[model samples]
Target chain A: MKKWVPTVIFLAVAVVLIVLAIVFLPVSKSVWVWIAALLTLAIFSILYRDNPIYRIAEHIFVGLSLGYGLAMIWHLALWQIALRPLFVEGRFILIIPIAIGLLYFTRLIPKVSWLVRIPISIALGLGSGIAIPLIFQATIFEQTKASLVLPEMFAPGNPWPGIWAIILIIGIVTTLAYFFFSRKEKSVLSPVSKVGIIFIMLGFGATFGLTVMSRVSLLIGRVQFLLREWLGIIAQ
Target chain B: MKRRIPLTLTLVLGIVMMIQFFIPHQFSQDFKNTALEWLRVIGGFAFIIGLASFITHHYTKIKHKKEGWAYSPIALGALVVMAVVGLIGRSPNMNWIPVTVQGQQISVFTYLFSNFFTHMMIPLGATMFSVLAFYIASAAYRSFRAKSLVSILLLVAAFVIMLAIIFYNVLPLGDLGEWLLSVPNMAAKRGILLGASLGGIATSLKIILGIERGYLGGTK
Candidate 1:
């Protein structure tokens, strides 16, 4: 019932586990394995109830993640992609982006925070503009093209592909129609949309199922790590 | 003066990038690359804003002795330690503060950085995500009741997919499962994709044309 009880229990268990691992496992991997196991257990503690150990693990994860991202962006995006080209490669034209990027520092000054929008607008505009044709190409053209039935699909005794193709196209159209918000109950889209809703449900179900399996796989991986590597209970 | 410059700049860059996509000449290709590089540079700077915001939040929390303020110090400390190690050590070629580990000459920063990432970060991150399995199961038990035909369809699809994948050797629904996904699932996904793409393209055009000014920060 006490607040400190969880922390004490976690520490006591961690100490025992580390000592046990060090005594049994290879010395080189023992320390890291035990530490990882401890962290894993700490995260797992949240499943039962919110505890100090879980909080510590959660905070540390957030901190380390942000730090990793920060360093990565600097090294990859800034140094390699942007700065090196400008300073070392004598690409002075990069000064345009450099100047724009410098504007981001204006956020620190309350009066000139609006200046930060310059860089933002540049990024947003370029990204949006680039996305327009690319989205159409990737999502619309390619997907529609793929949905079309080919002669080779029904070639030779494999006529099942033709039926499946018709079914797929029907599913796609009906699904799209279901999303047609402006259709009246008396309209042609009404019946089509009704069929669309069924496909949507099936899609949702499949997606949910797939998501659960993925998460379970992740859980299985961590469990295997604990059992095989740290505990040495399972064969390598 | 304030809004016009950004709006005009956005319009020019947007038009340029869009036009460059159509023109596949060496000059146009080079222009696109240059624009992307510029975007990357500016994007890198954008991260600092997030870093600053995070630090400010924790700093304020600690300063005011807010609820659970005790954890803020740990969060901030871990962030600083990881950032310092990562910045110095992660870069393979930078080789700051060189040290030998297991016959490899590497920086102490790199050694510590990698250990933290591998041991601390990976376990913590993976476990955090993995634990969601329990919550999802709990949610399914609590709210995923099959009271309607739609709900039953959803349950059947999810159950079939899970059963087929997890117990592929035991279940004979492999072909059916695959069909369900490739046919019905693909149909719905493609439908959603088409709609979303249209909306996204429209929004993008709106932003480029200065019609969507919300990102400019004010209603004005």
Candidate 2:
């Protein structure tokens, strides 16, 4: 009875909300909106406590995403790349890809599972090879080039640009120096590393604030949907 | 033999792909395109393995009657329903269970998919993430204590950023917050990115040269 109390109370509140929504919502009502609101509430019930309703919603989400991904891959990849060319266009060369793709299913059989490594190796190799130069060009080279502040930044009337450029250069140097594990923290590197810690903290703080704001906006969206769209309590 | 063949394939393919990036010839582009197409097909089949693992895991849970096993059936049922509806609805000529709503023709499969995705998936996804707002607040309260100078700096920076975002018009700290982000934050981020990229390049080189044989299955 103790366990059932919360569930019963939740159901009663949900039923009352649904009834209110049905009665007060605009005449041009979307059943989808009602279902969405209920699902949102069902998921939010996890905040109160772990219950069967939240578990079911979570599991259903997992399964549905998997199914949706499969359907998209079937239509987008297999049909377009392999089947259409093999059957409709008489391109027998597609047999190579189809065979390679079929090797992926060999993972299901214990003895032949080693065959799965063939495709995996190819994919990983290609990915690694392609990423090496790109990462160097984009992240390392471009970022270092951008960090070099020219003296022209200080030539103009507006001095904030030059000031910010100096701060950026210092920040980048100190942050990089903090990660230098080759040498011990001597007197010279000690203060620089401390400065690096400050910049790192500031960066993380900004990231956390942005993340919280984003999550809060999502909450606000659900609240707005519940109030204005579902309950008609607020004017649109 | 199994491991050697795969390792050789990795080395050869990695070298070819790397070289192809430098070559702007038509043939090189065509080769890359064909290889990518093959990769896509293989990727699709890879998901089948994932789906199989999912089903097996859930089936075992339900079979053992584990705690909350009742929800397993719901999940499996949803998976089957969504898959069937999505696959059938994607076809252009799917005429089964046709219905006209307000003079527009639509299939039952399409309607089911729309309802399932918009009502079930979207709301669940949004609400799941929104729940993090409460957790973030709790975490911030616990971690924002100013015990040391570094901690105090972190707390102050976070407070300034949050306040600036909420009351940018009412307050004058927004410009300072923006400057902090664009200058020091960006610099630190770029430094981290440069370090990570260098590490990634090293790992990639190791993999391509067959020094990292981790991806290969266990030896017989």
Clashes of each: 0, 0
Evaluated with lDDT, which candidate comes out highest? 1
Q: Would candidate 2 be rated incorrect, acceptable, medium or high by CAPRI criteria?
A: medium
Docking class of 1: high
What is the TM-score of each candidate's chain B when compared with the real chain B?
Answer: 0.95, 0.93
Name the top DockQ candidate: 1
DockQ of 2: 0.75
Q: Note each model's CA RMSD in angstroms.
A: 2.0, 2.0
Judged by lDDT against the true structure, how good is candidate 1? 0.87
Candidate 1 chain A minimal-lDDT segment of 10 residues: A25-34
Show model 2 residue runs off by greater than 4 Å. A20-28, A185-190
Give the residue spans of candidate 1 off by over 4 A: A6-29
lDDT string for model 2 (B5-24, tens) is 88888888888888888998
- Tens-digit lDDT track for model 2 on A116-178? 999888888887877877787778888888888788888768887888988998888888888
Which residue pairs show collisions in model 2? none
Interface RMSD of each: 1.0, 1.3
Predicted chain A of model 1: TM-score relative to the true chain A? Answer: 0.90
